[model samples]
Target: MNWKNTTRQTLGTTVLCLAALAATAASAATQQMVSVKGSTLNMRSGPGTHTEVLWELKRGYPLKVLARKGRWLQVIDFEKDRGWVARSLTGSTPHHVVKSRVANMRSGPGTQHRIVGKVEYGEVLRTREKRADWVRVERDSGKIGWIAKRLLWGW
Candidate 1:
């Protein structure tokens, strides 16, 4: 091959490799919350309905999406449990689960804010807003307050 053709071929190969790398980085950076929209969403050992059911998740339950495969999503919960669920059963609405024992719910998004309530370990709360390192959450029990981001698990 001529020198010019060789250079062009090398450049095309480099561009293709770079594109693949970028796609992988984008997938790895994706961390989003998905809530169970159905009354009962089945978590499976594999990414299909034919797979063995690992468990059943109730409506409003939130999961952190790790990856996706066709119509299935590989997810992880606050307990660090990993499973696959049908994408149709989940929504993009954000939610959070208390990871720390007795996480203080504050009137504002900081330590200076008065403690409005306390969330026990494994408490699931709907995400209302986010400010800096704090997240505003509303419990299903009608309690609303802000908690430190690190004390909870979600997107």
Candidate 2:
């Protein structure tokens, strides 16, 4: 209840808050997204073709690039599946994967809009534009709509 103690507590709280914000910003700035460029891109345990294949990612599959080797890149997907892929098989196209079991693709950026299509879990959609918490997405079939950002995990 003394002035000194109150000021010290306030300063400690301020420092902790600033530290948290800095960490968040740093991580956000470092994160980069890339998409699978081929029909089937093999994700390996190591950064080369000789390594064990961990997953077969389809074209447009969004991956968070974590690190890079000579000709390969370490990546993680929406499901937290981590592996290495060839840099040539990836591109800078932005995309998102449905993290939820299912998400409604709406005509607009809110629930008020009519549902145009349904997106399934692990399904990748090309990112078009962002409006508030909703993102405009394009299905591979050529259908375009808006989906709530909370239901997706990607760029």
Candidate 3:
């Protein structure tokens, strides 16, 4: 084969390989999930042989996967906390369901406070702040008040 043809073929192959590697890296960085069952799940710094306790997760916890290193997965919780958990303990679960139904948005934490407006199911509320169990949500009409976070899911 001519040197020119050989060089051209080698360069093309190198480009293809580089492209494939880049694609793989990009997909790995994308966020994913590993299911957690039972009452609590432990978070560690490394995959196997826990060295530190990052946090504990309750049942029906959906974690955001940061990356996978061997048999362990780096995950983040709802509050944006990061840690590592074993891949064996994580899997897919379809039983979890979050209800969109919301009753009323009050000015304060309890129902005794003045009612600003009522929020129905499937309506998305923008959370502005949180005060203990109560979260301040922005309504569709631009009204804001405290709502119980426990009343809904996927906040």
TM-score of each: 0.81, 0.81, 0.48
Model 3 RMSD in Å is 11.0
User: Mind giving the per-residue lDDT tens digits that candidate 3 earns over 1-155?
Assistant: 99999999999999999999998887866556555756577898777664687777665566667888998888875556788888777665411212345567899888789988777754545556766777777754788887777764433
Considering every candidate listed, which one attains the maximal lDDT?
2
RMSD of each predicted structure: 3.1, 5.2, 11.0
Mark the regions of model 2 whose C-alpha exceeds 4 Å error after superposition: 1-30
- Per-candidate Cα lDDT values, in order, are 0.89, 0.92, 0.69
Clashing pairs in 2: none
Q: What range of 10 consecutive residues in model 2 has the weakest lDDT sum?
A: 25-34
Identify the runs in model 3 with alpha carbons over 4 angstroms from their true place.
Answer: 1-30, 94-155
lDDT of 1 by residue, 28-82 (tens): 6557679988778999999988999998987678898888899999998888889
Arrange candidates, best lDDT first: 2, 1, 3
> Judged by lDDT relative to the true structure, which candidate is superior, 1 or 2?
2
Error of 1 at 144 (Å): 1.3
Taking the tens digit of each residue's C-alpha lDDT, what string does model 2 give over 1-155? 99999999999999999999998976874498899988989999999889999988999999998887899888898888999999999999899999999999999999999999999998989999998899999998999999999999887
Task: Supply the global lDDT for candidate 3.
Answer: 0.69
